[model samples]
Target: MRAWSGQWRPGEGFGEPLPAWDGPSTLVLVFASPAVIADDTPPDPGGPLAGLLEAYPASVVMGCSTAGEILGGTIDDATVSVAVAQFASTRLRLLTGPIGGGTDSAAVGRDLAARLVAAEPDLAGVFVLSDGLRANGAQLAQGLSDGCAGTAVITGGLAGDGDRFDHTWVLVDGRPRTGMVSVLGLSGPHVRVGHGAGGGWSILGPERLVTRAEGNVVHELDGQPALTLYRSYLGDRMGDTAASTLMFPLSVRAPEGRQGAVVRTVQALDESAQSLVFTGDVPQGSIARLLRANTGELVDGAGEAVRRADLVPGLPTLALVVSCVGRRAVLGQRTEDELEMVMSRLPADVHLAGFYSYGEISPIGEHTSGLLNQTLTVTTIQETAA
Candidate 1:
């Protein structure tokens, strides 16, 4: 794979990423955080992607707007940022459709799978990107997972807005929107892919059963207000509850499909109402776990991510990391140290790129990897010989 990057000032138009890419091999594009776009920008404008499409043209492109972007695993700023990589062995295919708020993900999945399967190429993995503005996150993630089969793996994230939930934009075809998802199906014998996550959460106390729920909103838990259980855990930090825990979500997976959880800050807490107001819907009868973070744990997790990126079993074309924003916060000022560890520990000289995700969608443990909750996650892409 080949890589390219560019930065634009605060009021710049969507333009090609610096160092135009011109190669016959297929292209797989990964992008960094997109800011609050200038006032004159169109609602669903191509934005920074205008330049990306111009360069790759037929190459399959997929990524999300982020709170911040890391090109080749480094941060870029207030201007647009781009990292383009070329893979000579893999075939890249792109797809997009309505996701969240009344959409058929099963159909969307099948359509994507059919296109990928027809190619019958040895699989590397599927890269998915989402607009993290709504509750349909899990639904859309499942749709893409179901759509592709016989694939090496799937990795990506729910785009973030620094800490603002309302500032997400999904890559639609080549455009950006609030209610869309973009996926790139990469299949080839030479493509190498591996993923892993850090370990530390010791399930504290018995699991809290979900007494009532909807989509991502939990009105009640164990027949009591959901917030009450949460507060019980918060103790002195109750004042910092929702805002502190907004990026963390209860993650679950059924034998049937993948699940993604991203909690918005609490909307309201009513004891008499026996309800909890949530920005996203949470189904009743789901489990809720108190998410916790320790400085040491977060840094160690970065090493785990690097281990996966380096162990992918082949020559890697590039490494794209999709980590939970919650992890960054937990580490605080020490976050840069984590970045340094990741950049240095991974196999030397691999082009690295990634973004802090609102919710990470990379695989780690075989059982519950796809939809990680409030944890650091990593994914690596490369090439392997037959």
Candidate 2:
């Protein structure tokens, strides 16, 4: 695989958007600030991106935004940083659109699946960058399964505004937008994708009941107000502050008969409303877990995930990472430490790129409900055959 990335100087960075990319490639674009793009107001209709894709002839280009960046050990927002990978033996395509809940979400998925199946590529799977605020995260997955009628894997995360979901954006031809989701379709016979999630939290109690909830807001648990339940979970240790709730996480066990328990970060707590604001929706009647992230544990888990993949014969030529922005909060100034820990396990020469997400999407041993949190999702693809 051939992978590389550099800045986009408006003056010198001349090319078609699609052409910037190369063949059998998966391009990871870490889009810089929407604020920056809006203020500077450069000529971005078709963007250099089209030329990029035309240049590289990519299999897919998957990317999102970031509160921070880590490329070659240098992290900054000024970088229109990008990473590219070329799997010589692989063929791929990118599928994108916005799909809401109810019928819209299913429809979008079916349409995308139809196009994907029509291409009839080997179909490695689908990577998604979505609007967590609106899109039925699951419907897209289900639609792909039904429409495509295949067993390709789906992984990625909610394209969001760091931890603040109040305003999130997606990029289309160098433009930033809210309320839209992007999907990248990948096809290849030989590919490596690794994913892992641990809130650095050890499960607590025998598990508590989510007595009342709506979407991501938990009103009550164990018959008590959800706020009270949360307080009891961490005790006065929260130090009597409003934002203190940020330190604790909700470990939600999917309704009965499901195999995933996701760590949803607490974004806010309303005293008057007696409600808890979470990253993703928590349906009523869900079992709850109060969790924490140890700096070392977060980094260690990420390291282990990459190392586990490293055991494969050939080194990974490219890497795409989706780590929860919430974890970065827990890690403080040492947030980069976790990323570095993950990088430490990779070969220095293996090119890579990614973005921190509001919520991460990754398969848990091939499960249907695979979007998750406080974890790093690493996808690696290398040609195993000529």
User: What Cα-based lDDT does every candidate model obtain?
Assistant: 0.59, 0.62
Index of the highest-lDDT prediction: 2
RMSD, every candidate, angstroms: 4.4, 4.1
Off by over 4 Å in 2: 6-30, 38-62, 72-74, 99-115, 136-150, 162-166, 173-175, 239-242, 255-257, 308-311
Per-residue lDDT for 107-129 in model 2, tens only? 78668767876785677666677
After TM-score superposition, the amount by which residue 104's alpha carbon in candidate 2 deviates from its true location, in angstroms, is 4.6
TM-score of candidate 1 to 2 decimals: 0.80
lDDT of 1 by residue, 43-143 (tens): 33454555556666766566667766765444544555555666666676776766667666546655765566667556567777777665354555555
- Model 2 accuracy (lDDT, Cα): 0.62
Range of the 10 consecutive residues with the lowest summed lDDT in candidate 2? 34-43
